[model samples]
Target chain A: MAEFYSLRVNGVDREVVDAQLGESLLFVLRERLGLLGTKGACEQGECGSCSVLVDGELVCACLVLAAAQSGRDIVSIEGIAPAGVSTDVQQAFVDAGAVQCGFCTPGLVMAAHSLLERIVDPTDTEIREELSGNICRCTGYGRLVEAVANVAKTRIALGGNRG
Target chain B: MTVSVPTSVAEAVSLLAAAPDSLVLAGGTDLMVEVNAGHRSLDRVIAVDRIEELRDWSISADRRSLTIGSGVPYSLVMDGPIAELVPALAQASRTVGSPQIRHVGTIGGNLGTCSPAGDTLPVLAALDAQIHLRSVSGGRTVSFSHFMTGVKRNSRQPDELITGVTLPVLPGWQGYSKVGVRNAMVIATASSCLAVDESTRSVRVALGSVGPVIIRCTDAEDWVVGQIDWERRAVDDGVVAEFGQRCGVAARPIDDHRSTAAYRRRAIEVLSARQLRRAFPNG
Candidate 1:
């Protein structure tokens, strides 16, 4: 039996139908809600393509069941830049030529955003550690790290979390 | 296909007892991986992550042990108070899947899966951790060694739920080392943990991903403890080499797809020696 779930996604109260709590939140967001920013790949939790923030903690959406997340706050990549407005991390990625295939871009952006929020200025090692979970199959990681480092500098100069 | 999200351990225990074969979902890191890969069919699941009681922890009144809830996430266990008590477990937890995986993966899930490569198992074995399990029938505790019988196999009855694990906080130095093809986000090709008890003047070494279950080198432990000065945390090169040799000998590695038997044995030796050096850095 399917149940209705009301999820606080991207600062909006969204309702999803035919919600199988057993299904991944990724399915609900992409297929049901039609918010495709949070990519789904390697559904085994190895790929961070489906990374999202549930109550401010970053988790792989594929590994997390929807039923377990009812009435919870979820911040996806789509929500990170409200109303399609670009975030600093997004701009930095474009400026630094970080995206090659662009499939892993959203997740990397979100992961980098999460780090910058906490670590206003992260070292190269910290950036590597934080973003290692989000794989860029195109092997554009060197520029990805450079882009994230570039944004961290901008965020620190602008004085913190929200720029 | 029922997904029961029990808010309490008692409810979970009853649900699991009612459905003996129901999969107990802690972090869902391993179970979901199997489900996604079409490796196993998940019929019914008892999701225990929501149970707050299963996520709590407390140190023994005698101050000799720490008991962490089965549902405690690796992120929590690897940081702050828990890490202070068992640094070896903390280091092992840090090496688990990734930040996203660690955010939700629990010590209980590592035990439940009973994978020989499980990063926590070797640490638990070295610490001689006691696993506490409960069911509607009754509650009992088992040694970490006794709990895991084989790869992805455990003595845990379907009706039973892991309540928590009680690890003795011996006055000692603890260290862990894991070898993998990549620096991050890769499972251990081979891993080893070394825990030295200062009070008892004992040394225990456990090798991971090199056998059917976490292999504790009892002879090597006795040899290392006997050879080293417990007070100074000092050991000669010969003692370290002999201890590593024993660990290499004890590892029952095979030519699995992940690694060759010879490479796995060599890794055990290298990791064992490195972890011992870390446990007694000055030595």
Candidate 2:
């Protein structure tokens, strides 16, 4: 029942071998492809810890079939930045003290990236709503919201450039 | 296990007919939950999201009906011409899970799951939308009332695939409301959709999560239609309260983990009354 397939992730074509069709995209990404940045918490879509962008749309990787994502473009946490390089959102998280346990950071970062990509200068309410799917057990949402808002403000100051 | 990715409706249906037990995967919002929980195992899954025919939608030439494809995601329903034509559907779509969930969850998935708490069910029921199904055998359309059989149950056959739903675009106002544990990322404990058709001088109300299936409050609908002045879009406060009471009486909620039966019944009354007032601002 194992299948072989290739998925375009982070602009790279990666081949997955001997994977169960029932295995989730989250499992395949972490276990098969060695992409551990996307955390698996609550296995269900509720936790949002497994958030990823498949075809530029934010979704819970735990809720997607590994084989079904064959032809789709997937962007994982590890793919978002250069090796050991943090983006503005990641830097903002550190500046705003948004990283506590760090388990939810990657998912939160992905959600924040998705929001800013669509709405460069998102309001506080928009940021909160966009990140609502992600849960930080540390209960550090206030700081997370602040981090996203600061990034949005910086982007606005730069004339809507997501640099 | 094997997975089939069909790019067309014909291929999808033929695959289903060939392998009737093939699990249909759309958004994976519900099926993945079960899979992750280890409650079910998939031997064969047919991914239908790739079918462009199931993703496309079209409006009737007369502008009286809007047919939404099964694979149309809730995010598309949140805002657009579809939202303008069926505001109630948009409202219901907004209440489904979260922004991430809305991105992939499809109306057809909601219909396939047929959970009583499915947000879009009440709106579809109130609108009297027709569910279209197709198989290698043929195609047939079923009304929303008969489509859902019970909680997480439907009339869809193993060989049939839900192609789309046709909703009538009425002139009058329509809206959807729900009460959950919290504002976002929560399932509805109780929900209601109220829609009015000025052309037909009719009022329709449907309740969700308070019954085994989407409960159409015919008593309340018939009573409200008589009480409202269609030309003025007005009704009496007492009439609205009575309609709400009737809607509450129609609920078949049970005490469960999500909510108490009494609370669900009360939520239905409050939701129906509020929706009735909002629809008839002059009340």
Please state every model's RMSD to the true fold in angstroms: 1.9, 1.2
Candidate 1 Cα outliers beyond 4 Å, as residue runs: A1-6, A19-21, B281-283
TM-score of chain A of each: 0.93, 0.96
Weakest 10 consecutive residues, lDDT, candidate 2 chain B? Answer: B222-231
C-alpha lDDT score of every prediction, in listed order: 0.87, 0.93
Q: Worst 10-residue stretch by lDDT in candidate 1 chain A?
A: A154-163
lDDT of each residue in B134-170, candidate 2, tens digit only:
9998999999999999989999999999999999999
Docking class of 2: high
- TM-scores, all models, native as reference: 0.95, 0.98
Per-residue alpha-carbon lDDT of candidate 1 for residues B44-145, written as tens digits (9 for 90 to 100): 888898899988999999989999999999989887998998898899998898888888899999999999999999999999899999999889999998
Candidate 2 colliding pairs, count: 1
Q: Worst ten-residue run, lDDT, model 1 chain B?
A: B274-283
Residue-level lDDT of model 2, residues A109-128, one tens digit each, is 99999998998778888888
For model 1, what is the alpha-carbon lDDT of residue B260? 94
